[model samples]
Target chain A: MADSFSLMQEQYAKILQTYLQEKNEIGLYHAQQFSKKVLENQISPEEVVSLHLDAIEKFFPDLPQGARDSFEFLLEVMMGYGMAYREHQSLRDKQKELETEINVAANMQQTFLPKEIPSVDSLDVGVISVPASKMSGDYYHFVKDENNCIGVAIADIIGKGVPAALCMSMIKYAMDSLPEQRLQPGALLENLNRVVEQNVASNMFITMMYGSYDPRVHHFYYSGAGHEPGFYYNYKTDSFEELYAKGLVLGITRDTTFREYHKKVEPGDFIVLLSDGVTECRTDEGFIEREELTRFIHQYKHLPAQEIVNNVFYQLEKLQGFQLRDDFSLIILRRKV
Target chain B: MSVQSNVEVRTEWGIVSARQAGRNLAKEIGFSSVDQARITTAISELARNIYLYAEKGEIIIEAVEEIHSTGVKHGIKITAKDKGPGIKNIRQVMEDGFTTSGGLGAGLPGVKRLMDEFDIDSVAGEGTEITTIKWNS
Candidate 1:
C-alpha cells in the first residue's frame, strides 16, 4: 500500500507540475504511473477527476477573494450549526433547572397565598391569583387580625426572577413584625416603603394596593403604591368609581407620602383591586382597552368574586392572537349589611 | 365547612417573580385565618432566604390530613430546599437582629414563629430544607 501510494503521489506531483506549466499533455512521470495502474486500460474518467481534485488541494495557488469568501461561509455555516446545537442543549439544561426551581419556589410562594378568603361575619371575600410564569412577582394577601378587621393587599414587585421574590421576603417581614398592626393603611405603606428601600437594591421597587375593612362600619379604606387604581362598585349608586391613593412605589421613595382613600362599601357593594396585568393584557385588537376593562367589571359587578375573576381570565384567553405578558391578580370584596 | 385540605410548599431560586402568588392561592382555598397567616409568613421568609443567600432553592406545598381539631383541621405543609451556601451557623442565623448583611436574618426565626410546627435541616455549602405546618382553625 505504501509503494502504491508513493506511486500515486509521484503521478499527482507531475500532473500538478504540468498544470502549473499549462501543458496540454500529461507529464512523463504521470503517464508512466497512470499506465501502471491501468495497464489493462480500465482507468475511468471519474478517477481522473478525483485525482485532479486531490492534486489541486495540494498544489493549487490561493483562491481569489470571492472563492475564499465562499469557503469562509461554509466554515461559518458549520460553526453556526454547531453553536445552534450547543444552544439547544444549554437551553434544555436551563429549562430543567428552571422547571425544578419554579416548582419549588411556586410552592413556597403558594403557602403565603391563602387557600380561601376567610368568611368574615357579613362580608363575602373571594380572590384569585395567577403567575405569568413558573414564578411571578404579583401577590395579594388578606389577613384577618384579632379585631376581625381584614387587611388585604395586592402587590407587584419591580423586575422579575429571584430579586423580586427576595423583596417580597422583606416586605412580609416588615408586615409581620409590625407591633402595631392596626395603623391606617397609609402608615402601613409608609413603614413598608422604608423597609423595602433599606433592603432592596436601588433599582428595585414594588407597586402595592392595600386596604382594610371594618365590618362594623361596612366601609373599606384603601391605599395604592404606584399600582393601578382599583374600582369600587356601589350597588346603591349603581355605579363604579375608581380607588386611587397617591403614594410612591416602595423601594423608590422613603419620604414619599401616601393618602388613604375610602369608599363606603354597603350591602351589595364590591371593590376590585387588581394588578396591571389585566389592563395591560394585549390582544389582536390592541392592549386591553382600559375603558373596555372598566366596562367589563361594571357589567359583572353583581357576580360572585370567583365568577368575576374567572370571566376576566376567560375573556383574556379568548383574545385571538393576544398574549398575557404579565401576572394577572384580582381581589373582590363584598359587604353584605 | 369541615373539610380536609392539603398543600405542599417548596422553594427554589429565581423560579418566578410573582411572590404573593402563594398568598393568593391560600385565599382561593379555605384557610383564611390565623393559621393561614402563619404559613404564609413562614413561606415568604424561607423563600426570601433561598433567593438572597444561595441564589437558588426550591419549595413544595401540599395539603395533608387533618389533626388537632381546634379550628379547620385542613392545613398546608411547606418544604423548602436549596443547594446554595448553607448557613454558616444556624444558631446565629436564627438570632434576631443578627443580619448577615443580606437583609435582616428575620427569616428563619420568623418562619419558626409563624408555623404551627417548624423544623430545619441545613449544612454549609450543601443546602437547607425547612418544613413547616399550619392548621386552619
Candidate 2:
C-alpha cells in the first residue's frame, strides 16, 4: 500500500515537471487530473505539500523564491535545458557524419594501392603492414617491368592521417607513370624529387629507400633519401650487412641529389626493409637498440620470410604491451638457396 | 606481462589454428604435456562449435598470472564468442548425453571436465560467450 502511494506521488511530480518544461496544455491537464485522483485516495494536504517540496529540492535546488514568480523562473530554466539538449543532439549527429566520411576516404585510399604483392619467380617476397589508426604513413610498393627487373620501394611520410594518405597515393601515381625510368635509381629519385617539390606542401617531406633488382645480373642497385638503412643477410657468412646511401629527404629542395649504391646478390641472400616503427619499438627500459634488431633478424633468418616477419611483429607487440605507437611496414625478399 | 593471441574460427583451418595456439600458450605457461593436450582438445571443441553453429566467431587465448597470500599461480584462459542462436535451455543442454546438432554431444560437458574453471552466458536472441581456464600446479 505504501509502495503504491509513493509511486502515484512520483508519477504526479513527473507529470507536473514535464508540463513546466514543455509548457504543453495536455501535460498540465494530465497533472491536474492526477492530483485530483491523489486527493480522492485519502492523501492528506500536508502529505501532498511534503511530496512536492521533496521533488523541488531534488530537481532544482537553486530556485529563487519570491524574487520572481515560480512559474516564470521555471520557464527560464526550461528554455536553457531545451537549448543545451538541442546543441548536444546536433553535435552528436555531426560527429557521426564525420566518422562516416573518414571511413569512405580510407576505403578509397586502399583502392589506389596494389591489391597484392607482385610475383617474381626469382624473388620470394613477404610483407607485413599495420597502421596506427584508420590511415597509415608508411608505404611499400613493387613495380615489375617486361625485362623481369623489379623495382622495390619503401617509404615513410613525416606526418599521419589524411594528408599522409594523400601523399602516398601521389607517390604511387608518380611511380606508375614512369616505368621507363624505373631501372635508374638515382635519376628516378631526382625526377620524383622535382615532382614532390612542385606538387607537395612545402612543410611536408618523405623518406624513401628505392632499389632495383636485376635477376639476370644478380645485382641490387639502390638509393636512399634520409630513409632507414636496410639489412642484408648473407647465407655463406651467416652475417647481416647494412645498406647505406646518402641523400636528402624529398620535398625539401629542388637541387638535392641522391646517390645510388650497388651490391652483388648471391643465392640465399635476403633483403630486409622496414620503417622506423621496427627500429624504435619501446620496452620497459627504453627504446630497443638497433643491434638487438640485427641479432633478432639473424636468429630468425632461417624461418620462411612470412614467419620471420610475424614472429618479429608478435615479439615487439609483447614488448610494447600489445600496442603499436606508429605505422609499421616490413618487407623481406629472399633468393632461394 | 602476459602473452595473448586470437584466432578467428570460420573454417577447418581456423580450428587447427585455435588448437595450435592453445597448445603453444599452454607450453609457454609451463603446463605439463598432458595438460597441453587437454587444452588443445578443449579449444578445438569450442572452435568447432563456432564453425558449426555461428559459421563465424573468434577465440581468444590469454596467459594469466594471479598472486595472493598463498603464492603465485600461472594459468591460461580461452574465451569463445559467437553471435548465433542462443541456447534456449542451458540446463538441459549441459547434460552429457543431450545432442542438438547430432554428434556425440560431448563437447561442452567434456570442456567443463577438462578445465579448472568453465563459464557460459547466453541470451535467447542475442549471443553466447564461453570461457575456460586451466592453471599450472
Candidate 2 residue lDDT tens string, A1-337? 3347668768867987888789998997897887678645645333454456556756787766763245333433333233233334444666899889989988887776667877777888878877767788888888887878888889888877878888988888877777564458888888888888999999889989998888888798999899888899888898888878799999899988889999888999988889988888888889998788877777788788888888888778788898887788888888875
Candidate 2: lDDT over CA atoms?
A: 0.79
Candidate 1 chain B minimal-lDDT segment of 10 residues: B1-10
**Candidate 1 lDDT, tens digit per residue, B1-137?**
22322332333423332124445555556763333344555566677777777776666766655655555366667777888778778898665445554423244655564567888788888988778877654
- Candidate 1 — which residues are off by over 4 angstroms? A1-87, A320-322, B1-137
Each model's lDDT? 0.68, 0.79
Q: Find the candidate with the highest lDDT and give its number.
A: 2
- lDDT, candidate 1, at A52: 52
Q: Model 2, residue A67: displacement in angstroms?
A: 13
Q: Indicate the residue-level lDDT of A288 in model 2.
A: 94
True contacts kept of each: 0.00, 0.00
Summarize candidate 1's per-residue lDDT along A227-331 as a digit string, tens digits: 988878778778777777887888887687789888777788888888888777887677877677767766666677778777777777567244457777877
